[model samples]
Target: MRTAGLALAGFLAAAPAWAEFTTGDALVIGNARYGETVTAFGPDAVQAVARALRLRGQEVEQLANGGAVAMQQALDGFVAAIDEGETPLIVVLSGQFASVDGGPVLRPAGRETSKAAGLSLAAVLEVLAQSPRRAFLVLGEAGEATALEALEIPEGVTVIRGPAAKVAEFAAREMAQPALPLEKSADWYGLALSGHASDGLAVLTHTEVRPPSEAEQAAARDRIALLDETAWQRAVESGAFQAYLDSYPQGLHAEAALQMRDGAPAISPAKAEASLALDATARREIQRSLTQLGHRTGGIDGIFGPGTRGAITAWQRQSGTDPTGYLDAAQVARLAKEAAQSPAPSAPRPRRASNAVSAQEAATWNMARGERGLRAYLGQYPNGAFAARARVKLSNMQRGSGQ
Candidate 1:
């Protein structure tokens, strides 16, 4: 059994009132058998880390002798779970770490010696970058300083990498206690590890976290207000939400921004009203056209309210129009023509063969079904050709529901 130090109790007592402990999830991977060579203590160290995490009230997933396929699946599932909320994440990796093409890659248990077979550290960072919460990554059997130096960890994430034995020793000692505040634990771990030689341990983070100054907090608030305004202005534009997420992945409006970016249409009521230059007949014509194009307009009332605007935006997006949810003379004519050509409601559309379905086509197909289908399509082809449009549709749907 792994001995947990008094770190947990100390953390609870010493941490600031705002820094209370919260439940989190941990992934502990240990591979003792990698082709021919085996780390004597790798498996033991992983168990120790898992025990420590569990003692601190974290949900733990432990994998022993995990191969490439298993590791990939585990990481994908973990990332997806974290993306659903602001859950804290802890990752403990023990095994061979190889440096390839001036970067670091973790080697899972397998006979593959080819560098291409290994998992790149950059790839791991990319998934973690999508997380909107704090993360701690502890690496064992990764003593290569050059590899650690070359890593570009994202902000809000911390990394500790070192020799298997020494890294495991430090983790065991720290976790043996009740619990220590994460920041304090990192500080303590850094100090303890630094006492060893460079070859023994290494620590790196994108930025050193500290309590924000009053001015900094005020600046952040101002930036958030600006972001909110921008989101309102470009709520229908996927690029706008993308830009917001790029700047503040975990911002206050992050969930809202994600909904917009994924395909939720957020038309400004004022903008919609001002842009409505068409007479009632034209508006009804557009609504009927949208209905023919398989979009719902909530009874075609000839008003450019949320329902009509949402339907127009969906149709416009599908038909490769500007998706402004406002129709000009030319666009109205084109829509009328397309509506005339479309099959009646009872007619069956041709279905593409499964193997022949392109990612974009799949996205469009799924989007027509509903939000669940759109989400499934995104899961299948997150970076597919029509992913942007699919996201837009989903965002619009969520926005329609007032999310």
Candidate 2:
């Protein structure tokens, strides 16, 4: 009974090893010459793939400027090199997508190469599908989406790419500013690469990740944190997002995650208006709105000047209410009503004491919030109504701070 059990366990252990193929080499084709035009973007992308794969212990055969004939030869060589019995096989291609009737073609080498022989994504996937070996296909430039859509990723093979525009733009930018030769710093575009690789063990690119560096990991972490749930699902489903959240659950996005789990309410656009203080932009917007309503709330510069408050008061008066000068929900409503009723009147001069009261209130509110540059705010609009209150709060803060 013990011998039989041991034999069964041994077979189970050997089963997975036999079921998968694991060869350690790579074929990087950046076929830029489609019947003889230099394709800089495709070649550049292929070089990037070659460098990345070489670092990962793969024997790399890089073919540049090869049109269709050259591409076929390389594919044949690749097949010959890998033992069908092994597990993982990686094939990366970067080139223009040629639409040939119904099928998509990867433009290959030579001036005379027919546009057709360049393998379609479907054709490539079909060839890869023959063996249960794990395969990785990267369609860098044109037809990326169409190819991904056309090819059914064999159960063991993985397919990864973004839209053609995104891939092309990224490849161009990466080539323009190639990472420092062989530098493993995190800034090597590792973050973006990690984001792309989140779905599975996949090709690394400048947009997906920096080559391999400390900053690369940091950038990757930050990028991962920023990924929305839908994007996260894509990565997780692909099986490539590394870095355990439990290891650094309280990392940069810790706050965002906590907020999400806490069921934080979605901030409405209307609420954004009320949350404003006397920031430059906020002041300008308020003044503009008030001026349009005929309240003439000061100059258009973002300072909440006395003119703005006076306008608020007039708006309040016109609407049958006491003018509190400061903008609030009620004030906005009154101003909107007056605007609807008649054409805007000329800008009015400030009322004595009313502007001062409003200023004081505004200052008090600022002090309550512990906003910096209160002195500057006061200096700009000294005659505000809440001057006394602002002064009191400022003194209290100074005292508490032991200043």
Candidate 3:
């Protein structure tokens, strides 16, 4: 299948300094020098987009045929630069986008194929979603509308997928004029491309495009109400706010949740001192490191629950340190360093057994009746003496039930 081209354009028109796109960040990428199938107009499209963005008083980062590392670095820098909520982030990608596992993947210049050297659309969206600013993504010469449609874009983000034939033409026009407003540019491009029988132009925004279902809206409201409960007023921890945000990212109180997360007030001096002695974030990091090293802490939720403390103690014992549940800064650092050096633990493989069922297995054999019980028994002892019998019975039962 042929890879499609894409361009992501973000606009923060609500900013006070927005004088027809006087300030914003633009990343223009063109990957034409691919070892495999390459878009001939990719480089030209990138240059054109860069020129247009520059004319709009936007700081443009133009990369032509840059490989994966360079692209990642540029994207990271762009994301970091979007510190201010008012600043817009625009990304113009003029490269081959291959569909892999029902998702879009960007093919870099040096890669033989997108599967071997492509960036996932999910990763790109994650980077864009990090920015608090409202983003507008514009795709040029892109296909796979299904993949794009499947994306769960954040609340303020917008997407515009342009027609494949008109992508190069639009870029060329922008290069020549450079003063056209983004909306006008999109409109003109859409109009020109509408004549094509295979035209696939769409204007997508989270608000104007994808609306939440009634169930989803109700859940969001419930989460917002939970956040507004009086229990959180006295002790507004980062985790509490994070939980709320996780549940209702685009909720009515999303802005407030962000503020509380970013600017959480200091606790009392005594409380502060106590917390400093046992920093939750630090403890969570330690727990993660321990879990990665095969010492299960139940989970890494930042809460130093009994499971976490026990894990910490076990880790301390293994490291030849005093088995203190609490981890000091130095101890945490040491644990982190050790964990980094150790190989990542893999999932446990199922144990192989003989065909003969054991005494314990025989004891549970009577309980193994009906669909659920038989399935549970088979799961526990797949290689048991009655395994074949169980399978035949299960299959017959399933077939009889029309399952």
Quick one: ranking by TM-score, best first? 1, 3, 2
- lDDT string for model 3 (69-91, tens) is 45665575455334334345666
TM, every model? 0.40, 0.34, 0.38
Expressed as tens digits, the lDDT of each residue in 113-164 for candidate 1 is 6665665677776655554334566677743445555667777556666666
Question: 1-403 in candidate 2: lDDT tens per residue?
Answer: 0000001123447542211111244666665544424444454555565565544334455555454544565675465344334334556666666666547777654443465766666666665565443455655664343543444465655554544334434433432232222122222433122111223232332221213234324422322232222222222233212221221244333333334334457533222232332345655556666676666653555434345546767766776775555455655555556556656556553222322235555545444334255465555545453333335335434533446
Worst 10 residues of 2 by lDDT: 1-10
- Cα lDDT over the full model 1: 0.54
Judged by lDDT against the true structure, how good is candidate 2? 0.45
RMSD of 2: 25.4
Q: What's model 3's TM-score?
A: 0.38
Per-model lDDT: 0.54, 0.45, 0.51
Alpha carbon deviation, residue 66, candidate 1 (Å)? 2.2
